[model samples]
Target: MLKIGEVARRTGVSVRALRYYEEQGLLTPDRTPSGQRRYPEETVEVVLLFQRFYAAGLSSRAIAALLPCVNKGHPSTPQRHMLRTERDRLAARVEEMADTLHRLDQLITDADRRAGAAA
Candidate 1:
């Protein structure tokens, strides 16, 4: 077992964030007799997964809801639906970001061409 601080250090997450994960039902650390939090060694990977989920725009509640599916290696019907929905949303966001990047590239090319002509 690792202490909460050790988990945070290994995962590069804050102690406060780990506590928040517990509050959100995302992590369940064991408590010592003195009430200090002790986590399993696997918690580092779990915290990294939580960071990825957060980057993917999942709320804490969403992550909490999906944890069981993740642990079971299979999602229920509603969980499957939710996964699909989030995936579609992420796909659209990626497309939009790509389009924006293309537009910015075009603008930069145009500016470069204009600068070359002026010189």
Candidate 2:
């Protein structure tokens, strides 16, 4: 078993985030006699998964809803639908980013043309 600090360092997650995960029902850590949190080695992967889910724009509630299916290794139809919705959202975000990049490129090109004309 590892202490919470060690787990946080190993997983690159903050201690507060781990505590929040526990509060969110996403993680369950063993408690010491002194009331310190101790976690198994497997928890590092779970923390990483949480980080990935967060980075992918999943809300804590969505992640919580998805975790049971992951733990059970069987996604129900609704869970699959939730995942599809998230995927579509991500796709939309990517398109928005691409559009923003294209606009920035155009601005840069126009600035370059103006600079050339000035010279």
Residues forming the 10-long window of minimal summed lDDT in candidate 1:
64-73
Global lDDT of model 2: 0.92
Question: Candidate 2 clashing pairs?
Answer: none
What overall lDDT goes with each candidate model?
0.92, 0.92
Q: For residues 51-104, write the lDDT of model 2, one tens digit per residue.
A: 989998899999999997767879989999998999899999999999999999
TM-score of each: 0.94, 0.86
Please list the residue runs of candidate 2 whose C-alpha ends up more than 4 Å from where it truly belongs after superposition: none
Best by TM-score: 1
Q: How big is the positional error of residue 74 in model 1, measured in Å on the Cα after superposition?
A: 1.8
Evaluate model 1: give its TM-score: 0.94
Off by over 4 Å in 1: none
